[model samples]
Target: MSGDEKGPVLQFATFQSSVDEGFWHGLSSLKLNKLKTDETPISIMGFYTPCSNPHVSSHLTLLAESLPTEPSDGLPTATTHGNRNKCSVPGTLYNTNTLEGYQSLDKKGLLQAEGKKIWEDIRSGKAEEDSSVLLRFLVVSFADLKKFHFYYSIAFPAVVLDPPATLVDLRPASEWFTLEEAESVSACCNEWRMSSLTADVPFFLVCISSNSNATIRPLKDFKACQHEDQKILFAFYDPYHGPNNPGWPLRNYLAFISARWNINKVQFLCYRENRGFADLGLSLVGEALIQPSQAWQDEEHVPKVIGWELNKERKVSRRVDLSTSMDPTRMVVSAA
Candidate 1:
């Protein structure tokens, strides 16, 4: 309870990028036919599901369906609405004309640019209205159609906390809540998850009354929830199965809670699942202490972004070559 006695700094599990072969094929078609020699930033969607298998981490996946059917007009494409199986997150694709251009690209600058959008969304209540915008991503790439190779780097930018959030306590949701409260919360969360209306909503407010009656509300209702005497916990569909750390999304979620609600002390729920069902044992409950800075109020100030994915402990672009399988001539040679 003492802010002076800092607990362990919060750590977040980073997202891994997975590009489907179909995505590359679709990009090839778009490049050859529609986007010839163009280096414009195209709006794309990335899909990810909650971590069901603890052994295998969930990835931010780019499939053929992620691309727009028509040319992009610098706006977000359609989302995987009402689909709990696949949550669609908006992203940008900067397909460079040449590999040199991709390599020389300012990674930090690009991350900050996207990070600023997230900041603006949090400031303007857009994130509260549509929580999906908090998951914006960037992929800078160079597709070599000649060789059927693709070089790209993905970044899931997170707004950096100057002092960082401190963990007050962390435990399984079952341990944190009373048996009655847990039951009520589980039932409420299942209803929210099963409903086609709110299944894909990644962020929400969980209100628990003194009698242990729990209800889930959208993030936009934060102001209303504040007036209620019920205990409010910021909840999100956590895509991590780590024993201790929450997922990357919490970084920006914390920022939104602090900036919008002016809540320095936060009680949060990392909602995880087991085999598509709510598992309070797998879920976690934690209290975080955040010291919101006044500098965040400045419209011009951009918080430091901190989500470039590491490749084998180093920050670098990953290359994928699909010539043998995708190329007709290569397939013929192999078959012969």
Candidate 2:
């Protein structure tokens, strides 16, 4: 738990199913971890709904298995281990069964109608189905003492569908930056343009600290210590952005290191507080420096937050050098 022993800690709140197969595949294929689900959870929030029918329960289990494995701590046991007998109702699914059900639901509008009926039935326990169950999973990881929590929420269309498709098939918008790209953007300063597709929606600014030993000091005590050399992963998202915000949701994820590790050096990543100052039309803080270049004028889409390192001296360093990775033509900062 000492600062020296702390390594990069991946922390995010996600459904239990998300950490199962979907998470494991991404981390493993990306070579993020030698062992899946090795990170510990610091906190978790989840919701659940009961399944009314044994068959539906089985399908739910199958769907859960399709998700990533790293966040599997809170999922139903039947889904986690292919163990139907252990649970009061065993959940299972077959590809053919799923496909046929989807096709039928789509053709007859049964998906929508039946989905509504299923919701009513589950809540009322009147439907002839076996048992009703719907759940949400939230998980957070620390190097140690990882946290996992689960709860129940109203079922939505996405939940009715077996193993929501979005979770299973997702790709990182940009590959992990190469060492060269990371270095070049380190020193370059350029005018960056960013636009949130949804102005009304609040977007998340996620930063994964590169410093293995970095700990999240309480907000009250954060300003004291230094040593800001942290590798930061950045992403942004507006849930209102249709099916998904590309990788914005994932990018905006924030990891707060354990405060117990280091009481003095408290640090966490977040958006520049003054960013929206212009939206308020506030006067410039002081003399403003203006530089013009075709590159500067080019419209580039960057995340709302820039990921950088702040040294103990309070000097900031860029993590992913966007200067080179950006689309030169549009001159977009493209954070998410």
Candidate 3:
């Protein structure tokens, strides 16, 4: 297909900052360690698309079917408390697709057959035979947009999926003050840090309704939904904010990363709204503004990191110097 018919292409830029000078010193000290380990830094890439149309279900199904299957080794072994075996039970196959009339009948039959196969595997003990199952698959789902609400819960022997332990309602605040919000969000993030330090398992938190009008504190203050080592952070926001509120969601997100986490980079995938300009204005703003520019080739490129020097008191009080460096991409957000 030609470039025009290839579908929407989104771009992203990620920034990294260190609050503790020791962190930077330690990183520089580790330069030789990295070379010895031969571990190359890596970045993540994702695609975002509108989830409201008829094609959403088909897209989700296609992605799920294409995912790599788990190996035959026994599931990850766990000795933790609270009947850990409960998590070992394979998840139920759910049908999140909304269909009408005759379409519903045909789809339902196909889904039932798929579900049956998965259920049989679980019952026969064929699914739980892998030791690294838990860490093998990622669950990709759109928790907000109505167009694509399907969930792809991978079946792995080593990985165990945990439900949300805490719910944070951000609707109470009327507005957010950048720095102040950061502090509050930092407190919430402490919870995740503590969990990560204690339990060796991963966790996750899903923001139910993030929008411009919705009160969002800094990311540091919000508690971490999962452990620090997990590979994913699924964030959702209502796409109603205009250019003036462009930085709100991102700022709060940075706060989350600031508390006990070093964000090396970020990547974003955006799904353009299919509706005409009248429905959702065609302006380039917020997450939509990250598209590749003509000046920079159409292919996505990594962002440059601008460094700075800190004050004697260890505070970011003044800019001492600036330098540019290339690093692996960190976070990836798909916008649709």
TM-score of each: 0.95, 0.17, 0.19
**How would you encode candidate 1's per-residue C-alpha lDDT over 139-178 as one tens digit per residue?**
8999999899999889998999878899999899999999
Models ranked on lDDT? 1, 3, 2
Q: Between candidates 2 and 3, which one is better according to TM-score? A: 3
Q: Write model 3 residue lDDT over 1-336, tens digit each, in one string.
A: 122532232211111111223222222333323322322221111111122231221011111212112232232223321221111222222222222221233333433333344333333333334211112211211111122122222211110011101111121111221344333333333333234231111122323222211122223323452243322332322122222221112322222232124332322111112231111221121222122223222223212211111235543222211112212121122221
lDDT of each: 0.87, 0.22, 0.23
Candidate 3: list runs displaced more than 4 Å.
Answer: 1-8, 11-73, 79-177, 196-203, 206-336
Model 1 lDDT, residue 232, Cα:
94
Q: Can you tell me which runs of candidate 2 are displaced by over 4 Å?
A: 1-75, 78-226, 234-244, 247-336
- Predictions: Cα RMSD each: 2.0, 25.5, 24.0
Cα distance off (Å), candidate 3, residue 312: 40
lDDT of 3 at 288: 22
Q: Show the colliding residue pairs in model 1.
A: none
